[model samples]
Target chain A: MHFGPHLLLAALEGLVTSAVLALTALGLSLVFGVMRVVNVAHGEFFMLGAVLAWAITTAIGGHPALGFLAALVIAPLIVGAIALVAERLVLRRLNYNPEATIVATIGMLYIIQQLALTIYGPEARPVEPPFSYRILLPWFGYSGYKLSVIATSALLLIATWLVLTRTKIGLIMRATQYDSETAQAFGIPVGRVYGGVFALGAMLAAIAAALIVPISQAHYLMGQDPLLLSFIVVIIGGLGSLRGTVVAAVLIGLSDGIISMFFSPTLAKIIATLLVAMVLVFRPQGLFGTASR
Target chain B: MTDKNGFFDLSKSTLTRRTALKGLAAGAGLGLAPGFVRYSQAQSSAPIKIGFQSHRTGIGAAYGRWYEKTTAAAVKAINAAGGINGRQVEVIIEDDGTDPGRGAEVVGKFATQHKTDIVFGTLFSHVVIGSAPAAGENKMPYFVVSEGHHVASTKLNRYVFQPGITDVKSQIESMAPWIAANAGKKVTQIFPDFAFGYDHRDYLPPALKAQGADVIAQIAIPPTESSFTKFFPQIPAETEVIYHVMVGPAVLTFVKELGEFYGPNRPQLFGFIDSLEATDINSPGLEFLDGSHFWEGSPRYAQADDSVAQKAYRTAVGIDDNGAAVGDPKDVSTAAHMFGCWETLYVVKKAMEDAGYKGPEDRAKLVEATEALTEFAEGPEHPQGPKTFNGKIHQCFGIQNISKVEGGKLKVVHKTKIEDGLYEAEGDYTTQAL
Candidate 1:
């Protein structure tokens, strides 16, 4: 309960939040970067991942670790498939028009949310962590699984960075992002790249939800907060900049935790929002975002 | 004829328009015409429509589901036993989406579109507060089951009533004596930062102080907060009891984090059952609450000395001994508070009958009738317990159950008397104009 330990605990908690926010925001950033269309249903995809995790784990009915591992692998894949179908049926049909796709994705959000509510019911159900180790500090004990989430997120971020920088698929996506018409002219299959990027973005969100479900119970309405936070990260980190998204997520998460410790939580939120507003006024391009061409 | 669903079959009514006209003609010819009496008789056959404002899709949806079920069961019972004023009771539901703006709009729809005689069955305090002005503007009697002190504080208009459940102010006040005597003297409170939390934050200290105990620390967490370990350090080192009352989906995480923070050497934990309503007590990460105590508006787990009415009420509501749905153990009922929905419906029926309520025109009479009632005895209709109604403030005073978490189930350890929660009236709703 001392100042040092309190600050340390706040920072640790903030790291876990930042890790999830980074992954979720990265998904949104990628879709915008390549497709130039906002996916409003991104949060619902995250919710779907968590709900599917619950169903898969319950169906498996074995060791908690086995079920959790199964969820980690399967939930994202299922969510990604669903996202692909949405792109084909809705987004592709809209010709990926920015305004039309925004509306279409909003429709998808409701459909996914209502479907989850109907199938999963209105309860906030918790999933047993893969492991239940408590890291007892001299000051307080912490969930070992939470720390694992941070590490897992970091590894995933690195893998994603490696793919974007080094792989042919990443090269195709980036060329399409830079100029879809030019990429198409060069036989890059711009449409296919868009579809793959959309699916991958959703998959990232799903993965984050799966990781956080043990720490926070999966409820039908749980997507709202994450969606809002991810949007903040996406906007403040500079849209379409993965690096900026990760950095902004960490900055916002840590500040939120530290500020809340000093002031009332409501006041903390006001201060955070004011800070975001100031950033917007001073640097419209965001902290790392370049000026638009 | 009445249908099996307890609604009247209007097609099978014996009194046709022709027959009514003939009766009126005959009465006029006999110089015994009583058109008003005949009109009243015809109107009495129509069903009483009660509009239910539900939280079907938002944060309060879990509680809303059980509230809907309890309301249905209560309505079915009331109709089966000859409903209010010999008319069938019909419920029309409108989801409020658990948003204050949506709540007010729903109340307006209930008044103008549904044309319901009364709007009832709202649970969340914010929703109730937001909807009350619309009810007052429309002059539709609004009977909410929300346990918020807003109704008792007389801050809302005269149309709003909280006759179904005791408000949070009374519930919090009642816990002080029992907590100070049994739990601990130096208490630290942890609650969500909102109107609901403010009720406890503002009321508990004075009540505890009166009982020779003091609240050492009060930590208010943001409503959106999911992680709580960072805030755990705010509890004073000399704290003896942690009185936590949190609501919403992240409650499981909060408890889990609290457990990890304290490990095995934590202080005594006393929390309002609102924190875990509709949640399984034996859930993973809740091992820390094994011996903690909670305040239950109604006992979730059936006690050995449960009254006959309580047993019958549980059966009627389809809740088992463990307070889960009869067949689904995992689908836990919000047994602590959902009983208010049932009890409130019965109160509505009683008031309607007392007022001879036949249509919306008699809404004022119905409100007056409800306010005139003073007490409800423990029976099939009033299953939670006997309660004293403060008609002036439009809130109920009821005994509260203090239950301990033992053997992975909440066992009733103490029941506070109604007087323990009674406080001087803040204001009188009767003083306001209808």
Candidate 2:
């Protein structure tokens, strides 16, 4: 009703968007960080996750929670496994050449998109939220599911941070990221590390899709925007910096939400693009990014 | 003998030159005598090839999938009923990818590569707009089933016509009064930012104003936008009605987000079927819209008082009473907009017969014949309802349905008359140089 209340609501909406964007962008950053190969089909993996979630939920049948839980556990694993296979068969065949992988992943994008079209059909299908309850705000009531999405996404982000900081696999991944040839010299199985990181990156994207699918319908064409937005986030964050990606996601996501709420979506996009230009001009390596040698 | 659809059936045993003559006599009774006579000539009885310019692989893919099915079913029925002119009706389909440039290219392919007699079956407004000039240049009769006002607005040449479907202007004009009175007077409009959405943005205000209502806030959203919560906060708090007509792949998200943003303290909701075009109403998040109203070109679910023709058409199209494919419940029909494909095919048939269209040489004659058509009856050809075709404007005036969500199905609560949508012709396609 009042300006203050509306601003608060806008911020709340921004947080939800930021939460999803962080998970999705972190995946892209992680893949670029360790592998030095940009995955053009990352968005397709996200889309596949949502589609598989729909299929599994439809197949499982019964209480939505059961189907949703099963989808949450299975869809990302399936998507990550598919990404692993792609890395092994396609990226490995190309020797993970940067320019070649771009073209290869674009091909992968179309292949996965068409396959989803054939299997999922062309309809945007709704997956029932596992539960629905209202949380009353000062001005209006909000969906309980959205709050859960924000919470779950934050938890997933924290878990990712913990894994990267505290685990053996994370240490191997960090070593690989530091220098693949050096890591190989140290008996790290660099190729296997690349494959695992690729899979992990895809899994993070799939997890984000699985979480958001209930709010947004699963569609084959749904990948394009998220792909574009994720690219923007990664670029503005400095290509391979995970911390920068998270911070950039929050900034872009919240600004996009709040600006779109107050002014126009077109204006919001214009401002975001301008901000990207400004960031690239002043801080070419990004805020948290280390300058390359 | 007759079939379930009241079509005259010929016994397989009676197959000869005399049988063709007998079929001519039967055709006379069925008002297909000209077609039969043409068939009897026997010099050229090849199937009348209609090129279907489809959006098989883009944002419009969902609508395209259903439109393809409906077109196939219509062609199947027409072929079964002794073909269009005793020659089988063949449909040659090419995927346009729903891109405007590709749309025009597809039209060019139909004109040159396929050598289709006529090109038809494009749905998205931008695609139709992009492709129409190509049809004109190629002298191909372009019969569009798109609901965009572009055809009727006469931005397109004489080659384009939207005779089977009502455009957004007509639809909004017809329903504005009902929306104003029953839903609310002061409205907050949320529409996709595009030509199609712009039609609603442009037309609805004046139409609503005519009914003593005003649009308070007009929020234009990017068509491809998936998340919509940010846009919801922009709607004025004092707004009594939220009028939404969103398109693209994120319609479910748009509606679900609106529901979430407002919850129990929301304003009245009125939406075009575009908001939930291919979505199930009983979807968990959409329960908030239990009593909201939607404007449908045709009711998604079959009503109790559905006409016999509607029933026959539904059976032919494989859409069950619930508006899903009979074989798969989850495969929901794009029931609102797809009827145009079925109806447009019939209009094409009628025009072809009226013109005694023989081949590509008589394309001009067929166009003129289509322009001469005034009315279509509520029958198998137009299961949506009877419509009045304003051939001058190249648009149709049809019954518009305002349905409420009841028990997870749209039940028609209001139906507007053809006259409610009538307006002065924007520019006459008939007057345009052919």
The C-alpha TM-scores of every prediction are 0.93, 0.92
> What does candidate 2's lDDT look like per residue over A188-275, in tens digits?
9989988998999898889889988998889998788778789889888987787888888889888987888888778878988888
Point to the candidate with the largest lDDT: 1
User: What's the true lDDT of residue B3 in model 1?
Assistant: 67
lDDT of each: 0.90, 0.88
| C-alpha lDDT (0 to 100) for residue B141 of candidate 1 | 94
Candidate 1, superposed: residue stretches over 4 Å from native = B1-42
Q: List the residue pairs that clash in candidate 1.
A: none
Best by TM-score: 1
